[model samples]
Target: MNSAKKFFQNLAKYLAVALLVFIIVSPIYWILVCSFKPTRELIRVTPTFVPHTVTLFHYVGLLKETGFMTYFLNSIYVATGSAVLVVILTSLAGYSVYRCRYLGRRFFFNILLAIYIFPRVLLLLFLYPMFARLNLVDNLLSLVITYVGITAPLNVWLMRAFFTSVPLELEDAALVDGANRLQILFKIFLPLVAPGIAAVAINSFLMSYGEYLFASILIVSDRFKTLPVGMAQFLQQYEISWGWLASGSVLIILPPVIAFAFVGRYFVKGLTAGAIK
Candidate 1:
């Protein structure tokens, strides 16, 4: 009787969770279906769950007619660049903090954490004006630098936590065998902690990709605009093309989805590595 009762309880919990998942995913599934339909079918009084006849016209127009391709490429560049830079710099910073015995290390880490706790939006007011003074606005390089700085702190903190779980005796053994700090890091430590690095990369990529406020404020020219900003302009007050808008939205979400799907295991491993230990 007890086993039978437990079985039904577990079944009830699974059904509830499944329903919640369906609710969350339903809107995105609808958007994908609408992207294939035309403008008229998108807003018909009768809503259709699945489109009858699919049209590639909206996708084609966004690709060829509008500057969507340029924006898409820019987003790829910025996100990729920022993710790589953050992974490299933050790994080194984290290793130094976790593995080294430098003076005032705790103090430096405390200050760094405090900065991260402070909202980035607050920093934007000061940074935008300073960049304007230096004529750094509207430059891809400046945007890249800004992204790196913003993504670095949290990555460093997370990685530092992960690295704390690594055995220091391994480094000591390598050092006794005449290996230098850089050699030990490149050869022994990095390979073992690769999961954490991958997680940091994914986090940085998402942050850079979804960054709308900074991209909107910093970029002026249509050519240098990222996907987020382009999407904003795609939606306007008077006329919102549901089909075309949905198409653009689908296109915007594709890269991140593909990226996460590919690196998913690595991301999970990295984020949850030392978290369990």
Candidate 2:
């Protein structure tokens, strides 16, 4: 009786998990399928679960006609640049908060956290005037700077948490062996918290890549527009280009998905480590 009950319980647990996975993945699968379906098939009265006629027309049109490649490259540049800056800056800040015995360190950390209290639109309103004065309003650099600013606070907090999780004994031992501050930081602390850095990098990249609000407002030039803003061209005043939109969505989401796939383990470990600490 006990064995039977345990088996039944396990079966129920697996069933529930399968259901949740299906719910989460079904939309993504549907979108991928739809992107390949021909326009006529797409608008059929009876929706096809799978495309009967798969074609690359949407993808080809998206690439050739709509300046998709330009937007994609621009997005890659901004996202990669912001991610690198965020990781470097946040790692330094996190280390400072962890190691330095300074007055009001706690207050400083709190101030960083306080940045999130204000809405992004409100921040952008203030930031736009400053950028305009500096002649950075329509530049890709403006997007990079804005993304870094928005993403840094949380990353700094996460890095600090990761730093705290490292034992002080390691630093002390390195110091005893005549390792200088930079050496100790590079050789000891960094490797230990690598997962945290991976997590931070992924977060920053995704945030900057998909950010439409700031990108649209800051970038006026069609050539400088990122993927999100460029994709919005499909939405005309009258008719929506559902095919282009669906194909664009698939492409837009691919990078982040691929990124997470590679570093997802580290990302999970980093978050759990920070949470525990």
**How big is the positional error of residue 56 in model 1, measured in Å on the Cα after superposition?**
2.0
Model 2 stretches astray by more than 4 angstroms: 1-4
Off by over 4 Å in 1: 1-7, 273-277
On lDDT, the leading prediction is: 2
Candidate 2: C-alpha RMSD to true structure equals 1.8
Cα RMSD (angstroms) for every candidate in the order listed = 2.2, 1.8
Clashes of each: 1, 0
What would the per-residue lDDT of candidate 1 be over residues 85-173, giving only the tens digit for each residue? 99999888888888888899888777667766767787778778878988988866667788888888778766754587789899999
lDDT per residue for candidate 2 within 138-187, as digits (tens), equals 89999999999989888886665567778989999989999999998888
The global Cα lDDT (0 to 1) of model 2 is: 0.88
TM-score of each: 0.91, 0.93
| Backbone clashes, candidate 2 | 0
